[model samples]
Target chain A: MTAVSATPTATPQPRNAVIRSARDSLVVAKRNLIRMMRIPEVVIFGLVQPIMFVVLFSYVFGGSMKVGGTTDPGVYREFLMAGIFAQTVTFATAGAGAGIADDMHKGLVDRFRSLPMARGAVLTGRTLADLVQTTLTVIVLAIVALIVGWRVHEGIPKALGGFALLLLLGYAFSWIGALIGLTVRTPEAATSGGLIWLFPLTFISNAFVDSSQMTPWLRHLADWNPFSATVQACRQLFGNPGVSQSPAWPMQHPVWASLIWSIVIIVVFRTLAVRKYRHATS
Target chain B: MTGAIYAEGLVKTFGDVRALDGVDLDVPEGTVLGLLGPNGAGKTTAVRVLTTLLRPDSGKAVVAGVDVLRHPNEVRRLIGLSGQFAAVDEYLTGRENLQMVGQLYQMSGRDAKVRAGELLDQFNLADAADRPAKTYSGGMRRRLDLAAALVVRPPVMFMDEPTTGLDPRNRLGLWDVIQDLVAGGTTLLLTTQYLEEADRLAHDICVIDHGKVIARGTSDQLKARTGGERVEVVVHERERLTEATEVLRGFGKGETKVEDHMRQITVPVTGGAKLLAEVIRELDSRGIEIDDIGLRRPTLDDVFISLTGHVAELKEDAV
Candidate 1:
């Protein structure tokens, strides 16, 4: 009785697409936002961990790292901000993908499936909400940093630009989280699977240091890392642009590259996550 | 409203497991059709397919004249579903649980709030409406879950063993609520393992085994298929049991089971009460004084056993 049909192409509509897509997105986003608000512990702790990471690294290692030609511990906060922002986005987004795996474990998504609501809303709403939460985490950490005497050298407009750039970059980071959550067996597994990437990706990039301080190959890898590029752009917005800060090196428009990387990551991981979610339920 | 639920050859598969092989179901408006099956027999799968949670591999289903496959949104607007477990967020209060569900159905702010209170009151959860569901009793939670499903007041409802874990009293309470809904001309498709539940609730019972429907008929029709009513004869004295068993075997050409320990002999009664009278007379002639003699009608249990060769109690890991 099973008739197998080829997969349908998910073509995005062009005209009046903003309104249509926004409605679709809100339908997905509202359920997740309500659920996240209902469970305050997850939201609070999820936001807290990133703040702790930022403060801990800034005080403990910031004083020692020679960054942007300064040995002062205060200067490292600028570098740490970019890295911490990226890390927080990863941390917050890890749940978006895993929500499905968790719901499957708890049979919640299975129940949701019985309803006639859009199936995609479960994943779509969750990822977007996580993106919003990640954005909030960035804002919170920014406040804490500002109070601790950290300031972005760039003007007000650049800081806003940096924030916008980082938001899109964070949106991209969550796509990977979505993929992990959908592909893993349990919420624990999804979480561990998702968080595992952050450790290696964050550590290898120039999130907390000048790439030149590391070995030549590690520096090269960090310089080319898309994760690092995102942090570089954030540093630029925060008046801490990496290449420009180093007087000997000619600066580059890494923001455009960061956006490209974000788009690529978003498209590829979203495709994989949706496919995995549909197949998991099917 | 002619056919609240209509499915033809509905099929759903999960990897190698055929949750639903090929099942067809039809229930006219305002009728209850019990989808009875043991665990893993795909009863929940059928419910899922009908509810549009899982698309059928190949089939056509329409609820309230809307093709479920084509216009699932419209179908969603017309029906409510209560899965095996309570889907209410334990974090939300009982009132909020209903309110959220009402909102999902697009009920307005004031309407959803009022409906939530009314449902809490109807389900006997008015006092606990402010408290989180995690603090509720098992019966209260089940009632709230059932209440959440009714918040939309959909014309058709799908209940997946709504009374399975409830105590007898709670089960009766839910049964009363269901009866009230059915009386109000609501169509229902219920999946259950309880023989008595299906017997008491469903106007038509479908006995499903191995992911396929094996039997479908009214409680009486299925009972009638078990041949005829059973004649149970009990002997006062232990020694009269042997003679009574033989005497009962002689009354009619029907299967007889003799329990020497209990001093009882039971056999199918082909000629009804007259046959029962003949058995008593034969025992009387044999000087076998009988303590009791009576005819017992076939029950849903008997029907299940006669058809599936398995009692309903073996509901382990089902669903």
Candidate 2:
């Protein structure tokens, strides 16, 4: 029954911009994670697709595909596991784009934009949340991979390092998804826009087959692909059999190339996405 | 003292259409200003500009003493907005939606939870607090969206057609909630196409059309401006409509309008009930048997027609 004062009761002290940005991002991430839990179908569907890929690829292409000059099903399984893990992580881009586009269509993005939070928080939070989901899917896929005779030859630390590189690449690609989401009008459009270019990007790389076996021009392009760099890095760190003998610099030092490519993508795309978030909504 | 919300000469355009064409507005502390307009009158555009969701191509706005263009985040901290569309997350439970809004407003997690529970009860969503918003009825989702806006107890609020799609009962419920907020000294700028809503809730009404404010006044003042009381006569016989119009025009202060379909004749008059009595006598003498006759004050509808040269197009089934 008390009359409210026109003045704010307590103005929150102006904190460091970095700290505020981080705090706001975490709040948004928490919201997305909660929504994901509520509709367990989204997470369950995400897990099902990767598991299906593992089983279908292992049984169908395992014996036919050659890795390091050998057509052994077991060796192909190990080689295929890294590519599948990288593919699983990157494919999360579509979900991220679709989720953001849905939010925009429903006016949820407007609600978030009107708040006193940091401008980049919405996109950063979304990308971070998708990264978590990708990590979970990767863990589950690794278990599924092990059941199909995929093995890590490196020590446990190196194997974990490989997973880290895969996640970083996934996080970077999500920024591109974020940009597409902001540009498109509907969730369906964003999902399609996100995936249309990715098929060629993932397939054209050395994720599924040896780059050296392809034509000279195609091999050069695949060896230098950012996606191929991550896949090759995972193979090196996991001590799998798909290490390339190509003279491409990325193939020679896959780990450093993976780091640089992911960092550049993160920097370029995050800036574009956040800028699009501000302008497109207006 | 200056008003709690103020804007001057705000202009925003999309390609060839000026969504907000040089609009000016001021809402004093603890009062409601209703922005009344028909469809596509830039009510939503004005609200968006004032709420810092869109930057005006020209002019300035201030909310709670902060410059909207220069310090939007600070202005954002002082205001709450419930847009035309219910912006609640469908996947999240009602409680979670409110809590998320509170956290975004920078409240502590525990405090956000406590506030969410309080809003759930106040908005009559206590039973549905744990249910996902997707399962909510249309009215329930609207209540939840309004509850989310009030989470911070902001001093200035903007609601853009908050009850556009609600049934009558739900609309009344929302009106009661809005009245309570204003009673607690909140400054509100509400945009609605319904004149009855503006008359019932606003301290002042601004009639806008084609992105321009045509008239601004208190409800009674606006009705007074439209003109004096009117004598409406519905003739029993369709053939007698012209006769009734002639007789009423003799007693009228202005031109009389006759509708052949309804066999009705309406005219403006000064003397109210006394004039009504005289008109009936005149019509009876002329053998114009009237089925219905009344002296009624000018409604906001009359004001809208007089100012804009058209009736406010109302869709009762918009929900």
Candidate 3:
């Protein structure tokens, strides 16, 4: 070991602290990613549910559900892909919450707190790692979607934009999960809390059945939903049906709505989650 | 700095319960100060406040010369804390856990790796370095957690009940490691419920109860406060206990306490060896056959009983 001062003389400058915070977040993210790798089950199980959703929803409801007034299995499958992709990314919330609650339960967060690292790095790192995991799950789900006759007719860049939007939504929701994870005492509670509300959130959106078939009030609620906006934007970018929708601003201007919704969620939830973290630990 | 770790009039409350009530502490550099207390004695709460993990409602602490509330980050840089719970990541390998801690302390990648390896070896965790800490026994996990705290080798360290659940052998091993750290110039403030642990390791011991410092001194000094040495004699026959008590009272300084079931009589005294000899001779002359007789110095247990009006609660060991 090298001889270093008990208290390092060079206190990190304000500018340096920002850079250090980013670096520390990456370090923590790396640890989380490594854990997912070593366990294998975390990623395996994460992929399993979305794949099940892809296969089950495609085969089971392909012919029955109507998309753009067509009951054709082929057309409906493409429409279903957008919903599955959105669902997969958002479903990652439960896993993110469970991960954090587990860490707190085991006192790992306490260990991190005792160190001289940036305060927000731990939560940011966790969400970042969950983002990476969601990315991988999305890629694998995209491949499964393609196999099941879902195509991106809009070409590569737009397709990439669609995937990027889905990821943004996922990353945004992961912050909500982070907040729940911080609040809940047990991982089990976090898991249930993360998932229970998400069911109605995704179901009532433009993701699954075209919200147009629903009654007036249900249609209105779904059209205005932020989740519905992201789903609608992905459908447009993917060059799939259901792009033409009601006059709700979020529905009509889906791309801007998706970006604005995700950005707003990130800003609001990240602040709340970080505040929750400091309070819970303190 | 006058003391490596110093605090004055520290007070913290959770709802209605005051966890720390006007607690003051001063641990000189390169020495060990043991905060000895029973369960919920606010020892852990004090450590949390001093380590900047929790804010105190009133008073101040300067750890390694950094004001805890004003410059918590500075205090963090100069101190390492191993909390009451062993705070290691169960998913990470022992080596990985240490490496992560090293990186958090801002050590370079290569430096972190090197330090992690050194710590694994130093803590006798090299054999299990590659294993996930979830598979580690309680003692091994504790060693890993302790190693994590030492990753940056800060000048001062706070260990809250560092050896609480370990078996005796592992406890001894940890004590050795702590002593070595102190020898290498690390000032330490360790909280423990074990009197024997404080007696063996602490340069000074502060006994606390109900969130306040009840007594403060070296082991011998605190023992002396309860009174001087005691003369204890156990008669072979229960009927002869009265004779033994009479003989003990002749030379004893305090009231003679007789236990009929054990046929034992104990009395406090000032003169140590001469008092013991006189008791033995008198008991023998009075036909009080003895099972055992000895002069006993007061232990931390007795001091605790004297100060708190009760025993230290968790008497896992006889001491």
Candidate 4:
């Protein structure tokens, strides 16, 4: 072993702080992803809920829901898959928040803060991990949707675009989760706080029901909701049956709306979350 | 030589309570400065400031010659910190935890892997290297945490109550590791409520109370400040306490104190074991029945009591 002299001299560390920060974030992300792989139960449990939603909503309410001027159960099932995919990605926010909150509660964030790495890397890395998890969940949910007779009439490129939008939306929401995780004191509180608002946000949107069937004010609210925009965009991209006439500009241009909404969310929440992280660990 | 850790006039307040009030510290390179304080005495707060984890309201700190507030990132590269709580990731294996930290410190992948294996072996965690830290005992977790701190072998280290929750055997083991680190010339500032721990580890002990340094010296120096060796005798009968006090005063160097209720008399003395033997022979001839008698040096406990008028408020967190 080489004897290390404890001289208080500045060792020549890698000077590119920016590059080091990016590398550090990737390292943290890798750690989180490895943990998920080791604990297959997390992935399994994450898969179970989306699978249940696909099966239950397909069989229970499939026949009664009207879409594209018809009550055809098959058409509704096809329409519902897009909403389920969007909801699944959004709901991953809870796990992201809980994971981050648990890290904070355990003093892991303190450890990261004391290190000479980028300050925002810990959070960005965590959100990146959630993005990977969301991507995997979306893949498994798509197969379940296929098993339930849901098919995309759009070209393969458009179908890929829809999945891309779902992942992007999930990534954006995970930042909000990161913010809540930093704000809350416990993992349990973060889980509740992360998922509580999500209920109304997803339920009141055009994901589960037709915004055209609701009252004028309700339709307007649902049409403009960011959640609805993603759902509508996915529906159009997948060539599903739910795209009906609506005066809401977002609904008419769901693809552009979904991109803009996700970009805006990523910008706002990432800034706030990183700021909160600095204050919290400092 | 430039001090490895130096801080001046650090002041921090949480609302009305000043956790650290004008605290100054200087720990020259290649030495250990034990920050001895009771609960809530600002030892941890001072450490936080020096480690760049907290920004003091008004202070100047230069750690490893980097201005803490101005170049905290540069300072961070030169120091390692093991906090009061073992901050190892419970979900990651011991080796994985160290490797992750090594990578964060910008060591290359192969170096991180090799270093992790080396640390795990050195910390006696080789057997559990592949097991998640959550499955390890408290001592094992602490060892892993300390190992993480040493991954880069930085010039300075700040360990806040590092052995607070360790068994005696584990604490001794950790002490040996620390001794090895210091022998390699690392400067350390360690904080602890256990005076014994401070005595065993610190080159210089700074005793703080109520957010201020009340005394600072070498262990022996501080002990001497409390007083020299003393003779303590508990008489077999309460009525003989006064007579015992007079007998003890003759042998002792200073005023003798008698506690009538406990039948005990105590006094400072210069002589070591020879004086103790003479006192025993004299008392035996005087026919004073002795229940217990011994020569006692001033321990850090005694020093703390004399200086602060209260025992160090030790919590039973140490296992």
Ten contiguous residues with the weakest lDDT in model 2 chain A = A1-10
Tens-place lDDT per residue, model 2, B248-290, is 8888899888888988888988887877888888878777787
- Clash pairs (backbone) in predicted model 4: none
Q: Per-residue alpha-carbon lDDT of model 2 for A227-280, expressed as tens digits? A: 999999999989988788889999999999999999999999999988888865
lDDT winner, 2 or 3: 2
TM-score order of candidates, top first: 4, 3, 2, 1
- lDDT by residue (tens digit), candidate 1, A1-282: 000011111121222445444444565576567668878888798878977887788789877888878878777776677788777776755677567567677656655555444446567777788877877778888898787667878789988887887888778877787777767758888887878867878898878777777887777677777877778778777776344342222125668868888899889988887777655552
lDDT of 4 by residue, A1-282 (tens): 011243533243674878887888999999999888888998899899989988898789988998888888898899899889998998878877888898888878878888888888999899999999999999988988888898988889999999999999999999999988988958999999999999889888888888899998888889999999989998998899988578789999999999999999999999999888876752
**Once model 4 is optimally superposed onto the true structure by TM-score, how far is the C-alpha of residue A94 displaced, in angstroms?**
1.5
Model 2: colliding residue pairs:
none
C-alpha lDDT (0 to 100) for residue A143 of candidate 4? 89
For every model shown, what is its TM-score relative to the native structure? 0.86, 0.94, 0.95, 0.95
The segments of candidate 3 whose C-alpha lies over 4 angstroms from its true place after superposition are A1-15, B285-287, B314-319
Off by over 4 Å in 4: A1-15, B314-319
Q: Interface RMSD (C-alpha) of each candidate?
A: 11.0, 4.2, 5.2, 5.1
Candidate 2 lDDT score at position A159: 92
Runs of candidate 1 exceeding 4 Å displacement:
A1-38, A116-119, A213-221, A241-251, A271-282, B233-237, B250-253, B261-263, B270-295, B313-319
Query: Each prediction's DockQ?
Result: 0.20, 0.48, 0.46, 0.47
lDDT of 2 at A118: 89
Chain B TM-score, all predictions listed: 0.92, 0.91, 0.94, 0.95
The CAPRI quality class of candidate 1 comes to incorrect
